[model samples]
Target: MAMSRNLTLLFYVTLLLIVLTTNQAESLSSQLSQPQSQSGHSMYGATQGSLNPQACGPRCTMRCSATAYKKPCLFFCNKCCAKCLCVPPGTFGNKQLCPCYNNWKTKRGGPKCP
Candidate 1:
């Protein structure tokens, strides 16, 4: 009887964890889908509806703007943007804004995206 009770408790705990994880994942998905502003205007001054391949230049430029190293920063930022189709807002941090851009890793196991 004790063993059965333990098993039931473990099962409930696992199910609770799964439900919590699913809710968190859904919340994150919604946040990632929505733009920073109600108007869909990004911090980079472009509307989400207007973003395109050609617009990567300005976005990447803005992302790499405050970096001490300009050339390499722009290079990698643009490359990541080209492939990921998005750039995290601001000069640094806020990587969670772009999952593809943020999840990329370098050969050395460091962050590949700026």
Candidate 2:
């Protein structure tokens, strides 16, 4: 009886480990299969691939006008715009149009875009 109980416990533990490991592997594979950028856009290719151009205009305009850092600004703006779908107007000091964009944060927890 003691031996049987020990065997049953071991079997259950082994089964549980297998199930947990399989779940973890599936999760990791799903994450790997999807290509994403820090700015929350799917990294399809160059030129902000697969984004709707219409939604990018406001953020692009704002970022273009606000920063001397053209390349990085554009990249950040496009990413924010892709997610938020709207950009606050003017060169600086207005973010009411898209609350989500305005509130976005970088990985380091700072403001994501200008």
User: Once model 2 is optimally superposed onto the true structure by TM-score, how far is the C-alpha of residue 63 displaced, in angstroms?
Assistant: 3.4
lDDT of 1 by residue, 5-109 (tens): 999999999999999999999988875766667665554533333356787888888888888998999999888877877777788988876777878999999
RMSD (CA, Å), candidate 2 to true, equals 11.0
Q: After superposition, how far is residue 26 of candidate 1 from its true place, in Å?
A: 16
Which window of 10 residues has the lowest lDDT sum in candidate 1?
42-51
- The residue pairs in collision within model 1 are none
Error of 2 at 58 (Å): 6.5
Q: At residue 106, give the lDDT of candidate 1.
A: 91
Which one is best on TM-score? 1
- On the 0 to 100 scale, the lDDT of residue 3 in model 2 is 100
lDDT of 2 at 64: 80
Candidate 2 colliding pairs, count: 0
lDDT per residue as tens, model 2, 54-96:
7576547655875778787778877887776555556664665
Q: What lDDT would candidate 2 get against the real structure?
A: 0.67
Best candidate, lDDT-wise?
1
Residue 18 lDDT (model 1): 100
